[model samples]
Target: MPTYAYRCRECTETFELNRPMSESSAPADCPEGHQDTVKLLTTVALTGSAIGPAASAPSGGCCGGGCCS
Candidate 1:
């Protein structure tokens, strides 16, 4: 299972959910019962004694997953 973050456009509330990868793109109902919600793009901070080249590299974009100018 993977965790997903969702933000409600109506109430502006944010939340998280644990679901299967196949349902990642599935729509989520906001806790406030708002239907206008979107899955937020999340990021990870890979900081530990054992770091990798990707984590050490400078952030390329907003999410640091590249795909940005």
Candidate 2:
């Protein structure tokens, strides 16, 4: 199962759904009965140093012990 994010255009409401990949997206409606919803692109988080130090440090100050000095 994968989690997907959806946004309702009518009400500008956002919500998350967890379902099987085989399942098709439903026309999600807002609590107020608005019916303009669209599925959003799902984002997966990288784990275990896959992003590396450069991604962790935006200032580039900690590389090669520059920050410590």
Candidate 3:
């Protein structure tokens, strides 16, 4: 349960809360019941595939010495 993003400075609503990160800094009441809230700074984007030996290409220019063929 983790989804917290709030912004409601008395009517400029924008909310979301599924809290449990220890309340995630509790204090949220938007959805038109503004409580002068402010707590939004989220960004998470991760895609698969990445683990051990598979990164070698940087010895020259244009294509690591292959001249961009």
Best model number under lDDT: 1
List model 1 lDDT by residue over 1-69, tens digit each: 889999999999999999999999999999989899999999976776755654555667777876787
Ranking by TM-score: 1, 2, 3
Alpha carbon lDDT of each predicted model: 0.89, 0.73, 0.84
lDDT (Cα, tens digit) per residue for candidate 2, span 1-69:
788788889778888777787764756666667778888987798677544445444554667557765
Q: Quantify how close model 3 is to the true structure by its C-alpha RMSD in Å.
A: 8.8
The candidate scoring highest on TM-score is: 1
Clashing pairs in 2: none
lDDT, candidate 2, equals: 0.73
**Candidate 3 structure quality by residue, lDDT tens digits, 2-66:** 89888888777787889799989978888887688899898987899889989876778766676
Off by over 4 Å in 2: 49-69
Candidate 1 vs 3: which has more lDDT = 1
- Candidate 1 residue 51 C-alpha distance from true site, Å: 12
lDDT-sorted candidate list, best first: 1, 3, 2
Q: What is the lDDT of residue 42 in candidate 1?
A: 98
**Winner on TM-score (2 vs 3):** 2
